[model samples]
Target: MESNQLPLRDIHLPEAIDWWPPALGWWLLAILIPLSIALMVWLYKRITRQTAIKAARKLLLQIKQDQQCDNSQKLKDLSALIRRVAISATTRNKCAGLTGQQWLEFLDQSVKGAPFTLGIGQLLANAPYQKSPPNEQDINQLTRLCEDWLNAQTKRKK
Candidate 1:
C-alpha cells in the first residue's frame, strides 16, 4: 500500500488552546464577595435580635423583683423595654406607633398567644399609667408571661 493510503494517515493536530480567561478569578470574587457580605449582614441581624430579647428578659426580671416595691417606675421601664424588643424583632413601622389596646393587640398577635393573652394584654395595656402598682403575684405572673412570649418568638424564628 502507498504511504498516504496506509492505515496511519497524515492527520494534522492543532496546538493546545487556553480557552480559560484570566478574568475568571475576578468574576468569582465579584460573586463570592457580595455573597459573603450578605451572609455577614444576615448573621449580624440575627445575633442582634437574640441579644435584644435577652436584654428584654433581664428587664422583665427586674420589674418582677420590684413588684413588691412601688414599681411604678419599673412598670414604665418594662413597657419601654417590651416596645424596644418588639420593634427590634419586627420593625419600627410595625410596632413603634402602637399604644393602649392597639399595642396590647400587637403584642398578642406577634407572640402567637404563648404568653400575651387578651386578659394579660389588657392588664399590660393599663399598666404604665396605673394609679395602683401591681402586687408581687401580679408582677411574677407578668414576668412569666413575658418570658413565655419571648420563648414563643424564639421558637417561631427557629
Candidate 2:
C-alpha cells in the first residue's frame, strides 16, 4: 500500500534524559571520594603520633639505663624529654612557654591525680636549679611519673 494511502504515522522519539538525580555509581563516587580522603588523613596522623610515642619510649628506656649520669643530670634529661614530647603532641605555642605551676597543671590534665603539682612531680620544676642531685628515691618516683605521663600520651586522642 502506498504510504500516504495506508495512513502510516511518522516515527516518534522518547524525551531526553534529565541532568538531575545522577546514577548510583556517581552518587557512590561522590560519597566515597571524601570518605577515602578522610580515612587517609586520619591514618597519616595516627602513624605520626605512634612514631613520636615510640621514640619517646625508647628515650625513656635509655635515660633509665644510663648508669654513669648522676641523678641531677638524669632529672635534667627527664625534664627535657617531657618537654620535647609535649611539644610534639601539641602546638609549640601551647607547651613550649609553659613553666613551673602552669607546666605542672598542664601535665596533670592526663594523670589521675595532680601529681605534677602536688607530688614528687613538682621536683621537675626545681630540677634545673637544684645545686645537688635529688635523692635516689625521689629520682625513682619522678621517673615513674614521667613514664605515667608517657603512657597517658599514647591513650590520648589526637
The prediction achieving the highest lDDT against the true structure is 2
Where model 1 places Cα greater than 4 Å from the true spot, the runs are: 1-22, 112-117
lDDT of 2: 0.90
63-134, model 2: which lDDT tens digit per residue?
988999989888989999999998888768998999999999999998898999999998999767776779
lDDT of each: 0.72, 0.90
Clash pairs, candidate 2, are: none
Off by over 4 Å in 2: 1-19
Tens-place lDDT per residue, model 1, 1-40, is 7777778856799987676664778789989999999999
Best TM-score goes to which candidate?
2
Q: Model 2: what TM-score? A: 0.79
Error of 1 at 27 (Å): 1.6
Candidate 1 least-lDDT 10 residues: 113-122
